[model samples]
Every structure is written in C-alpha cells, then in structure tokens.
Target: MTFAELPRMGSGRVSEARRQHFHAQVQEVVVWMRQYVRRLGFAPVARSWLYALESEGKITKGDFTWASKWLADRRKEGLIPFELVGADTTRQLTGHDNFDEEATPREYINRQLRDSLEQAAMYWPSSYWKHQTNYPILWSEKKDVLKLFKPELPDAIRRFAGKGQADVNSRLAVVQECQWAQENDLQPVILYVGDHDPSGIKISDGIAGNLRQIAKVEDWECGLDEMESDGRIVRFGLNADFINNARLLWIDGLETARDEAKGTNDLANPRHPDHGKDYVQSYLLEFGPRKCESNALIANPTAARALIRDELWRWLSYAGHKQWEAENHDASKEAAAAAEGIKRMLAMFDSAGVLYNPGLIQSLAQASLPGLPA
Candidate 1:
C-alpha cells in the first residue's frame, strides 16, 4: 500500500490508530523538511509547504499567503533562504500576491523567547567603579590636591565648597561616577578630603559598597579611604566639631568610668558584690541622650563650634591613627596591630598617670599619626 493507506500497528480503534499514525507521519515530514531546507540552504520550501497545506484546507489561506510573502521578502534580504532560478544564479522566484504584512506566529514566538532570556540574564548581579577627586582648602589657601569619592555626589557637593549632605548623596555620586567610568572604559579611584571621624569612615564604606553593587565589577575599587599613589590616605571630610562631639558622646568618659570603677565593689555579698548594674544603668541613661543630642547638633554650624575642644582633640588623634594605618599597613594586619597598640598605649597611659606625667599620651598620639616624627 501507499504511505497514506498503510495499516497502523496499535491496540486502538482503527480510526484512532490511523489518526495517531498520520500525526507521526506529519512530524517525520516536518523533521525531514527541516533537514532538507538546511542542506539545500533555501527558504522557498517553507512557503511552498504552507501554501500546499492551505490548498489542502489543513491551514487558513490567509496564514499561508502571509507566511509565503514573509519568507520570500526575508530570503531576498538574506534573512531567509532562496534558490537561484536563472543561468546567472542571481534571480529569485517571486510571483505571489495577497500576502500579509504582520509577523508570523513562529517569528513572534521566537521574539518572545529571546526577550525572556534577555530579561532573565539581566537579573544577575553586576558591579562597576566610579572615581571622583576633591580638594578641600585648609583655611582657604591650600593648593587643590586630588581626593576621590564614589558613585557620584549631589549637585550641592558637585563643586568645591559645596554643601555636604547625607551619606546617601555621597553613595549615589560614587555609583553615578562609576557608571560614567565604565562607559568610558576607565577604572574608578575615588578620593575624598575631609576631617577625620566615625561618620567619615562609615561614609567611605557606604560609597564603596554602593559602587561595587551598581557596576557589577567585583574587582573594581571605589572608596574615599583608599590610599593615594604617594602613600597618603584619603578620607571623607568630617565636621571637626562633629568628630569631637562623637568622641565625647561615644568614647571619652566611658573609658574613664569603666577604668575607675574596675575594683570598686559592694562588700555586702561576695557572689554578686561586683554588680555595678545600677551605676552602669545610670551611666547609659545620663550619657546616651547627651551623646545623641551632640551628634544631632554638630551637623548644624551654630552648634558645631561649641563642641568640647578636648573631645575634638581625641577624635583627631583617633582619625590620624586610622589614616596612618590605612596608608602604611595591610588591612588585616592593621586590625591586629591596632588592638595590640591600643593595649600598649592604654597601659603606658596608666603608668604615666601613676608617675604623674602626661608625656606617654602625647607619644601614643604621635605614633598613631603617620607623618609624625618617631
């Protein structure tokens, strides 16, 4: 029997089995057609097949006409395949009309798939670096030196002597700067110039993280605290008064109180004699609000200058220490060294106090600041 009249081998009704066999035959034909089209490097066969199916009433004539014209046009444009018809092997077959201009179903499906894949790929994390340079004057006469900061800064701080705002502005600036650098095929190196303080350190870290996230450049560098080429460290400018206020609020009296209260105990009950819980609670309540208020007020110029000078001195000393270590020591080593150094310095301070001398504190401060003579 011919291919269409052959008996289907299966345990179903004759018509059902025949239908299944017919579907399988159609699938095989499609597979063969694909192979034939690939090997012959032609597109007219797809149009011809659609036209034949339409004539046989298996598909709509409109669809067949549209597909045929699309294939023909694409083939002419080198987007589809075509066969040479003339002796010169340059002329192509073209006589059909009533073609549809809309995208074919298969083309539409492919476009959607491609778009979905692109969107999925986009969700993957990416990073980049953004560089900035700033120079703050020392009382208005210092030459401008390069100091970098990231992402991008706000319009306020975009130029010199501009208003410095929240950490968010600095972070966003760094990110924007990094994007600009990446587009221009340059690496970012952010430099900042500011007074030293806890907030400055925190801002540096924030800018670094923000740039790293935006550019998807895990290897990219962006931060104000980065070291300069000449081995000097850069930092975000802190309000000198803010640093002083923060030191007074967070560090100063707590260390003294803890030290002085070390051996004092209630002699009443040995098991819980050292429970200075009441004193600790009182310290927290009394100092916490003042510290919070100090932080809030220092950002205001009117309140900033009134910050205690001794607290500012302590902050400057601490900041100078951090800058020195960031410039001269490896980060991991610096942490360990700093801990040891602090322990040694504190012991020296205590020793000096017992001997009624203040030279040890000065020596420790000098040691912490990088450029000070040994």
Candidate 2:
C-alpha cells in the first residue's frame, strides 16, 4: 500500500501522537541549544532560522532578519531568552575568515585562569589584596594537581584549596611555622579567615588549639599573643577573640546564662556595689526580661532588675512610650501582652533610627526558643 493510500487514524489518537512528537522534538532542541550556546557563547538557530536553512541551504539577509524578529517575539512572550552567537557577530567582521587552532595551550590556560580569578575576586574586597600570597600554587599540569607549599616562601601564606580539597601540607606548614616562631622567641600569631559558620569556627579552634599545644611544649607564646600586643591583629573578622566574646543569647534561653552570671557577680561581691552594674544590667535587660521568664530569669534578682531597668531606659531614650497600649490591649491576654511588649521595645529602636534586621532577629529568636510561637 502506498503511504498516501494508508487509512487515517481517529482524530483524537492522531492529535495525541502529534502532541507527544512535538513535545519530544521541543525538548531535544532545547537540550541541543543549551549545549551549543554554552560552547559557542551564544544561542543556537531559532525556528525560522532552522526553516530557512533547510529551505535555502544557507543563511541569507532575509532569513537572518526573519529569524531575528522570530526570536525577538519569543523573547517578548517569555518563551525564549535572547542571546548573540558567534555567527551573529562574525557577520560584522568582514576580514575574519575562520577560527584558527594556532592559540597555545599556555595562552588558553592563562586566559581561563585570569577569568576565574576575576570572578573569584568579586566575592572579596580590595582590602583582601594585602593578605594575598603566591604560595599554595595551583598546578594545572601535574599528577598531584597542586603544589601546596615551598619552604623558601615566607610564612603566613594565604592559599586557595579548590572545592572539597584541603591542603594538608600547607596547614602543616603553618603548624611548623608556629613551632619555629615559639622556639625563636618570636610570638606566633595565626589569624584564620573563613565563613562565619559553625564549621569555620571549629576549624579555627582546631588550628588555634594545635598551635597553643606546640607553643607550650616549646615554652613560647604562640598564635595571636604577639599580634595582639603589637596591635597588628584586626579586632574584626572571624578571629578567636571575636568568637569567644560572642554571647549566643536567644529570647527563650536568656534566663539561664543571665541568672548564672548574675549569681556569680552577686556572690563575688554582696555589698550592693554599683561597679560592674553596667555589665550585669546589659545581660539582664538586653537578654533577660524580653527573652526569658521570671522563673528562668537569672538567679540574681538585683542584676535582673538592673538589666530590666537599663533596657527600659534604652526604650525610653528611643521614644518608646512605657504607657503606650497596643490595640485591643488586655493585660489578661498572654500572647498579646508578650507581643505588645516586644513591639513596644522594637518601636523604641525604630524611633531611634536603630534598624535591626528582622530576618536575623527571627532566625536567632527561633533558634533560641524552638517551641515558642514567633
């Protein structure tokens, strides 16, 4: 039987088959275009361009114009995002015949490395340039793939270990340098720079601990002592002091630590002394009353009261009205009362132009009181 004489299928069945075929074709074309664009740094041929190519066997002025308009329309309708390809620009370069394979491997590597470096630099600021070092060399042409350290290079070199790869030798070198500095009576200081997350803190702690042990054995002061004395260490950044000084107080857990600290201060000096009251007050007011309950409030009632007063003073200073009542206010309403108190305190800060990031506050608050309603 001839193809034209073949019996026709039901309209519904034919439509379903056509729909499946069209979907498959579209998916195939999308995948191909994605690969082609990534390699050629531009979009592949549009539908009209493909049709023209199949019809005319080459791209012409009229075909190019039609394809451009078709692609523009698709883009306008959000069907496709437009991009220029090699073919689009090459048409302008009349003297340029074709791409040549004469480019050296070194040139290509250099170009790629430069581009990668430029992209990486965007994550950090220009101030980081002072800490940049030439060590921890990235070796692209070696079995090991990286030359971690060179003995002749200066100590305290900052190096990038590509994703998932830690430079053990470089870390060991830092440890060795710390030991040497201690032996030579040179104060050893190692400032760790990493993300402000838990893993980063742990890594820094491990490094500091190792250096401390090494310094003790060698009877030398190692790791930041010298830098601190000389004022070379930046107080900011992810340093040991910054981490240690940080108080991880949450709204719910405030009473536990505040009460403990207050008890210690009260027991240490029971004479009702005014000294150190500021510190005690800060703990109670900023962390205790708002976040914790009376029972959970730190044991030193004096300190707790002082803190509450200090927070009240801050609120008052910022134009937070102590008597301002929230809408539908009822002293008997527990949740509303709590929320009202918080809003009043926050309003004080807001009035004073002190903006607290709600997202961060919410996150920390949630972490502190996992079961409490936000």
Candidate 3:
C-alpha cells in the first residue's frame, strides 16, 4: 500500500492486524490459564480459580471479574474448593518431652558432629555469598504471592513490606538500607513484583527517587552526600510480555483504574499529573492494555516457582555455585576435624593408666593433662 493509502495506525490494515494479533494473544493467555486451572482438576473450576479462566470471546477487563463471580456462583450451587494441597500425609514424630528420652553423652557428641556436618553441607551457598556479595539484596513485591513464594525466598535477603507501594517508612528504609549497603561496599538490588497496571509501571520508577528525596531531607545534613544513587529496581513480574507468555487472565476493572488515573476516561488530559497520558499510553502499547494480577501465577505453583527462581537465579553464577560447594566441603571437614580431635583426646586418656574409662572421668585431673601423659 502507498504511504497515503496506509491505515492511520501504520499500513494497509497493518496496525489493525497488530492490534488484532495483540488481542488474540490476550485471548490465548486467558484460555491457557483457564485450561491450566481446569487441568489441575479444579472441576467446574472453583470460585478461587476464576481469575485463571481462559474464556471465549472479545476479551475485556470485566471478563475476569465475572469469572471470579462465576466461580462463586458455582460454589453457591455447591462446587468444592480447589485442592491445591494434598491430604494430611504428615506423619507425627515420636515425642521426646520426657527426660528419659534425652540423649547420652556419646549420642550428644555424635549429634553435634552430625549437625555441624549437615549445616556445612547444606549452607555452603549461604556462607559463600556472605563473603562474596558486595551488596545487600533487598526484595519487595506485592503481598498476594507471599504464600506460594515465601518458600523460595532466600534467608539472607532483606524483605520489605512485600505488598503494595512501599509505605513512607518503607521508602525511608530503602534509603537507610542503601546507605548501609554503600558504606559496606555492597551493591543493593531491589527486585519488585506487582500487578501490571498503571500504578505497577510507576511503582518501579519512583522507589529510588523517593528514597533519594527522603534521604536528602531526613538522613544527610547535606542532600545526597556521597550517596551512590546507583541502585536500581527490577520489575520482576507482571511484565508486558508475560501477560500472554504466562497466560494471565485479563481482569476487568481497567476502566476504573484508567478513570482514577486520568480522573476521566479521556486520556487527552489526565489528572494524575506525573502519570498522565504518556504513562498510561506507554504501558498500554507494551502490555496491549491488558492488566494482570501477580496472584494469577499462583494457580500453577510449579511454573510460578520456576518463573520466580529463573529471575532470582539471575543473581548467581556457575562459579558462585561451585564456590558454595567448596565452602560446604570445608565446613564439613571442620566438623569432622573437631569430632576427631575429641575422639583422639578420649582415646589417649583411655590408654593412660590414670584413666581407666575416659567416659567415666569427672574432670581433666581424672586423667593426666593434655601435654602430660599418665
């Protein structure tokens, strides 16, 4: 098509084609998520699983909201809740509250050695990173994912409120933590997860600025004194591409959000000041104007965990993994060495005439001193 004959969006129906393709992707994502839930054996698709349903038709924001209500309707008609967890297969451990169940001296010594060895083996990554990292890891995200996500969180990383925009204290804390990270020669990374909405896009942008602003006034006598201002926030979830890639169902209510953002349906003049037309349209283009909740990912726990892990594992390396393994070996060896030293001391004392039974000895005097033999 000639330039003059081109469709206003781009080409001879090209813009229309792209828009259609984008909508198709949205529908595909919605359907995939619905199928994903149904496959999980949520027969009649329980009330809780509505946001995940992939429905048929021209997709809109309200379809998702209706899905949830549809699930509720099913429940009202007597549909059971989806079973995400298995039945109580937890076997009860033997109770040891009684003093008679206490460990003997030999057992206690062995237990200590075993525990130290296990910790060395298991926590070498923890140890290696402790010495290796130059920055503190501070992670914050929307609260909804916390349940399926808590298990995947690292023990060492600092977790913020993990819900919504960081509150005033939370924003201030970022500055304080950034200062701490800088003082320690550590790079601070903020991994953010939130909904893919007008505000979600803005949330990542303001955290650093908010921190700097708060710090200038409340922290340093002079504003941003020697502060690196180098930290960054990674919008880890509800990104534009993942909208369909993860098959997130499109929820209704974008109009309300849009209205709130612009203070009107028309984007010509938005009342939100900082987040007016540019902010709204930019995200609309990238995300196809379809919004999703972080919780939608929870429907498929394995995939959700895998997705989150993929993002987090970006922080580590093969070299780091190997280093952790080496640290673990060293830790285990340390434990083994301690056990051997104690064993040798007992064996040496047993050989001495002053000690008949090393286990029976009440004090060091019961046997010859370490340097002095019987």
CA lDDT of each prediction against the hidden true structure: 0.36, 0.36, 0.54
lDDT of 3 by residue, 1-374 (tens): 10111011234656666866644543443445456545544322232244433332322335556545544443353332333322222343556665533367766655665566555444343453544443334444544355455566555556654455677777777667666766665656666777777666677666566566687666642323333343345667767677677666665434433344445543323444543567777876665545676656655556666766777667645476567677777767776676667666756765784345455564565455565444
| Candidate 2 Cα misplacement greater than 4 A, ranges | 1-157, 160-171, 178-189, 202-207, 216-225, 228-374
lDDT of 2 by residue, 1-374 (tens): 11111112225546777756644543443454455445333233343234223222333333445555645554564444455221233245466667535387646644565555444433322221132221121211111111212221222233333222235555455556645544555444443333222232334435434445444554554343554465332212223333224321122221222234334323124333422455445444433422311111112223323333332232122221222232113332554455456556756755765434567666767897888676
lDDT of 3 at 366: 47
Model 3 gets an lDDT of 0.54
TM-score for each of the candidates? 0.20, 0.21, 0.55
Output the lDDT of residue 299, model 2.
20
Predicted structure with the largest lDDT when compared to the true one: 3
Instruction: Rank the candidate models, highest TM-score first.
Output: 3, 2, 1
Model 1 — TM-score against the truth?
Answer: 0.20
Model 3 spans with C-alpha error above 4 angstroms: 1-49, 52-126, 130-140, 144-155, 217-231, 255-289, 299-315, 340-374
Worst 10 residues of 1 by lDDT: 139-148
Please give the range of 10 consecutive residues that has the lowest summed lDDT in model 3.
1-10
Q: Which segments of candidate 1 are over 4 A away from where they belong?
A: 1-173, 179-210, 218-234, 237-374
